[model samples]
Structures are given as C-alpha cells and as structure tokens.
Target: MDGVILNVVTWSDMYYLDTWGRRQFMILGAVVMSICMLIVGMLSRTEGRPAYDPTLYKVNFDFANIVSAGTAVLALRYLYVASFAIS
Candidate 1:
C-alpha cells in the first residue's frame, strides 16, 4: 500500500518537473513526504493500547512499516532526481 503511494508521488513529482519545470515544488513535496513518513514510522513503533473491543480486533502485518521503507526509498530517488534537475 505504501509502495503504491510513494510510486504515485514519485511519478507525480517527475511529471510536475517535466511539465511545469518546478523542481522547487518537487523537492519540497518529496522532503515533506519523507518527514511525514518518518513521523508515521516513529508513531507506529511506539506501543499502543488495543481497541476498545480488544477481542474484536486481530493482529496483522505492519503496513505502516512497509510504507515507511518504501517512502525512504522514494525519498532517495527523489533527491537524486532533484539534484539533476537543479544542476
């Protein structure tokens, strides 16, 4: 799921840079997204209480962690692209 989001954002940034030639916004968006992902990862890592009806809930895979990982990769790629664009 997070992979999908990062892919979309990356494509969007590339598209914006190609069409509008706005590398500033592209870099800005990528950095903001990276920070948001880091925050999400930190929050997810912390222990949390179960839902009110604990019995109704079940354990599942950590999608947030997966997303954060994907976002980190995307952030690196974005930085690379931004560097080329700015230079």
Candidate 2:
C-alpha cells in the first residue's frame, strides 16, 4: 500500500516537473510525502500495540507484495535505460 502510494506520488512528481518546473515539483513532493508519513505514523501509534512486541502488529502481506513488485519494475526500468544509454 505504501509502496503503491509512493510510486503514484513519484509519477505525479515527474509529471509536475515536466509540466510546471523543478521548484513546484520539489515543493509538492515534499509536502505530500510529509503528510503521508505523518498519517502513517499516527495510524501506527493509534493501533495500541506495544513497541517491543513484533507479533502484536498485523502483517500486511499485500503491502509487502506491492512493494516487491514495484521494486522489480523499477529495477527493470533502470536496467533498460542503462542498456540503451550504453548502446
């Protein structure tokens, strides 16, 4: 979930940078990311789980799967770009 959100934000930032400029994209990305972090932090804290207990927290397999998939896609993208650039 977080990874998906981050990917969306990243793509949105790229679009903004292309359409508006670097300054606007930087500001927008910073603000959006900060808000997301804050929301996640608050939600985690409100779950009432002890900090020392790993088992108390619910495991989000969906989030993990999405993150892994996103990572693989990004890695492939980088490899393609690098290969093309080298040629």
The candidate maximizing TM-score is 2
- Residue 39 miss distance in model 2 (angstroms): 0.6
Model 1: per-residue Cα lDDT at residue 42? 56
My TM-score estimates for the predictions, one after another, are 0.34, 0.42
lDDT of 1 by residue, 1-87 (tens): 445554665665675576676757657666765665565455445522223446867643244436665455446555544433332
After superposition, candidate 2 runs with Cα above 4 Å error: 1-16, 51-87
lDDT of 1: 0.53
lDDT of 2 at 15: 52
- Expressed as tens digits, the lDDT of each residue in 55-74 for candidate 2 is 86644322232465445444
Displacement of the residue 68 alpha carbon in candidate 1, Å: 20
- Poorest stretch of ten by lDDT in candidate 1: 43-52
TM-score of 1: 0.34
TM value for model 2: 0.42
